[model samples]
Target: MHDPFVPHEMADEAGVHPVTLADLVAQSDIILPHAPATSDAPLMDAGCLATLKRGAVLINAARGALVDGRLPGAGLDVFRQEPPDPSNPLLGMANVFLSDRTAWYP
Candidate 1:
């Protein structure tokens, strides 16, 4: 069985993208982006967010630089800015959860 805590590669043997970042953003109800933070482009942010599945949950545990937006009820161990400003909107939301970056270590 696949390791439950880690994300496996999304390509198949033929090098086809069975599950792409684009695919995840557009279709998934729960998106855990474990992909690299590339300089290629920012995530297709607003356009994709608008089309996200209802009740979508985006946990940006890895690809922080690639995404920027407000998401509901996020349990975040990572953020685009470490120690985000007090004025950040998520900080005021009742459902959002933020953790210090050390929460993952033993």
Candidate 2:
């Protein structure tokens, strides 16, 4: 319900209420990044993570680079690097839930 590229008509047809990305992040209790990744920028970087409501959780079924590892908590199914290095900070965070990238496979 929060895609900038979705046409207004399409959104209306699908009964999706459109909202700005910033507004969605600030208000959502669980943020899901389903958009394609961009090489130049991450969809949810440090600043975006900071705006999340207290104790909010981020769910990234998309590319891992979409999120900054400094978030309060998250459920990640993908990583910027496949088989994230052992030294990755996110691996040590108890608040994070990591899954193999194949999480979406049937």
Q: Mind sharing the TM-score for model 2?
A: 0.79
Candidate 2 Cα misplacement greater than 4 A, ranges? 102-106
lDDT agreement of model 1 with the native: 0.64
TM-score (all chains, Cα) for each model: 0.64, 0.79
In the predicted model 2, the residue pairs found to clash are none
- Per-residue lDDT for 3-106 in model 2, tens only? 77889899999988898888899999877778777775788778877788987877787777777647656677788888999998879889878887665689
- Per TM-score, the best of the predicted structures is 2
Off by over 4 Å in 1: 1-20
